[model samples]
Target: GIYLPVGLEKAAYNDGRTPIWNAEGCTTADIVYDDLRTTNGWDSSYKIDFSDPCAQKYIDSQARMFADWGYDFLKLDGVGPGSFKSGDNYDNVADVAAWQKAIATAGRPIHLELSWSLDYGHVEDWKKYSNGWRIDTDVECYCNTLVGWENSVDDRWDDAPAWTDHAGPGGWNDLDSLNVGNGEMDGLTNAERQSYATLWAIAKSPLYTGDDLTRLDSYGLSLLTNREVIAINQSSAPPAEPVTASDPQQVWAAKNPDGTYTVALFNLADAPASVTADWSTLGFQGKASVRDVWNREKLGTYRDRITQALPAHGSRLFTVTSHGTDLEWTGYEAEAGTLSGNASTAGCSACSDGRKVGNLYGGGKLTLDNVVVHKAGTYQVKVSYISGDARSALVSANDGGATSHKFASTGDWGTVNVVHVPVKLKAGANTITIDSGSDGYAPDIDRIDVQK
Candidate 1:
């Protein structure tokens, strides 16, 4: 479990105090007294040095207290990365080792978790003594549009081999906690939240509840519980990699053990809307049963594919069980122009008039004209270009009869940029025009994938 500072514990003890920890104040009652030099005369620079009698006593005492409280896991924080001047070069490695020894000496079977980006190469040494440690910094409460927790995806946690055997039943890779259900979540619609949860489940990190559990709302509770959905996350098999995103609003499918699959349809748009996925591409031969995990409703069996309508910032989690023979190519495929390839770019500029935009890098852009719209619903157009580039691209889809939507590339190609447009279609004939913004550079044109 992740441990908050003693200051937070003190505030909780004192009927809660505002501004959390009073960083500037100095009192014996203040939780930071010893470390900040407000009450004790110990130098703040030597805060983490175990050789310091007061610091050692405080660390040892805290470990003992937590052990008594039945907390087998503890995350030691506030130990800054710099070296100690007064004590033996107080770095995280020494600090953690000291605490581990202290905890062992106290005769408690407590596990340790360290915070901040310490030298993970030393993880092998710490693992024998500690339980888990952070690969990044601490996560604050959800407030800003980009909550700190969302940044976890930017770094691949699975690439770290040291953490492999270290995680299981009682042990886990601490990827922080859920930022959803926190009323402060901004910039995310319900669909986006579902996507976030789905990603975490696939990552198989510890399911630490970061939201105020006592005040959980219905939607939040649904996300936390849905047994079938949660079961896939807890499964022992390696998770399926995400299908390529052709559009931000497209459905991403991951194969499950019993031949069924878990699908997450994300709404990259700010408003509530509905999107559709083609049945043929999903490998359904005829009709298949679909269950909506969130609503606990059966969407009935359908031949070929399933079409789901999602709310703004919300998504529909589905367990699609195939029936009868497998429809010729019934599983998801990356759409042509979207970030994930499972979308269709049939109506984009290049796909029109039988032209195709191919081979653009994941973060590149593409332009097509004379595209045809095969079906109609809500469609997400994504332009993936390289990461860290300051350049942006403008993409517009025109149906020739005056219906058009303009979407901008979200600077980073790996980041899915989305534009939602409502299209009305006849059974056989419709046209679309796509233009890459003339930003003095040719936008790398990946495939344009179209999802309903």
Candidate 2:
């Protein structure tokens, strides 16, 4: 996600630290069903008691007042299925539903956005209520030079394609903000800034200027006024999908209303380099015409593939006719899996490329296909997971055998950890399946990595 400067009035929640309702009629008082309360009860966040009727009144009244004040966007952050829980994540569906009721009935149309990286497993829920939400952390954290400028950008791009089909007209993915306009505070070079803006626009993420408009430089101004770039981003079509997710370079493309494909080729590495997008990988049979969207230059058609050299932290945006195939990753969503129970997802920030699976139930089953490898050998298979408590499941790699492994707890959902299992992969493609194997608690899985 990009960066955006946002102003919010959170002080009104000063009174929310106390108990949500009186303990008079509550039998679970000592049970501590309060979602926001910590062991010391010092959490400053104003979490509502969504189970209480009065809480509904408070939410509705606040929403109505905001609407009356002519506010059109309300971002409900820090509210998730699992808010401050011992598990990978907790659910706060009811909490968001309450606020939605208040806002939708407020006699005005308001855009509802959630924040702090909601999980992609709740796509249906998010689409049903909020207009947009964040999938990655804020970009301004890169302001510290110690962190390096490119690290932040890389983190956002790594997971950009996980939700390709999740955005559209009524709502969009929030890539965060346009931090590039702030000059030095942006901590990015001109090329990086333009790339950042291009990535956000191409992803169909909501655009918010995070820098001070008064002090914006010519470079930032030029980027904002780039009509061709804005046109691609604002297009009604769905966001682009990743053609190359992991690499020295990443490529994403989408079909436009005019049937031309808008492609973004990114140099995600430190050194300047050129790369190629094979025609087969891009889903095209023949050659095509290409136009560079950013530089407004028309590059003649080519056969086989499109090759462009980009400087470190730079990119090339092209609108091409006969855009080739759009290849999807062998991710959890694309695999064959049996998901029992609610078939919901829990997510974490450290997951590889924001990958998530739908099976969290004990009896659930997941089958992954097309796991490519170079040679047949034993590899250390690492599964990314986050859980409030220890969890385990039966996992078999390449149909060799099943072994139960416990996924350790990470203290919080945002903090992620991995467990290693030994698996043998044959040359070329492989498939692995997982089933409930222990204590019946299947940890939320983000992705799997096998290393020699």
Which one wins on TM-score? Answer: 2
- TM values, all candidates: 0.48, 0.64
Local lDDT at 390 for model 1: 28
Encode model 1's per-residue lDDT on 1-452: one tens digit a residue.
44643122332323213222222332223323343331111122223333434444555666677777777777665433411112223334555666787788666687676554434444455565566555444444334543532444323222322233344443445555665664344234455557667656654555666666777666777778877667767886444332323334555565666887666565545566766654434544567788876667888887766665666545566777878474221112124333322212332332223333433233333434334445554333333322222222334444434322323332333333222333334334333333323222323343344432
lDDT of all predictions: 0.46, 0.63
Give the alpha carbon lDDT tens digit for every residue of 1-452 in model 2.
21111111234333344332333332222222344342111133334445556666655666777778788888766545422332222455655677678787887877888765666667578777778877666666644532235556666665555555668877777877767775566777777887888888889988878677898888888888889998888878778755542355766777788788888888867889886665544445468888888889999988767888889988888888874444333334312344455345544446665545645675676667777777897644556665555556777877588776645444445545544455678989888766664337666666665432
Task: Candidate 1: list runs displaced more than 4 Å.
Answer: 1-65, 78-176, 179-205, 210-225, 237-241, 277-288, 302-304, 323-452
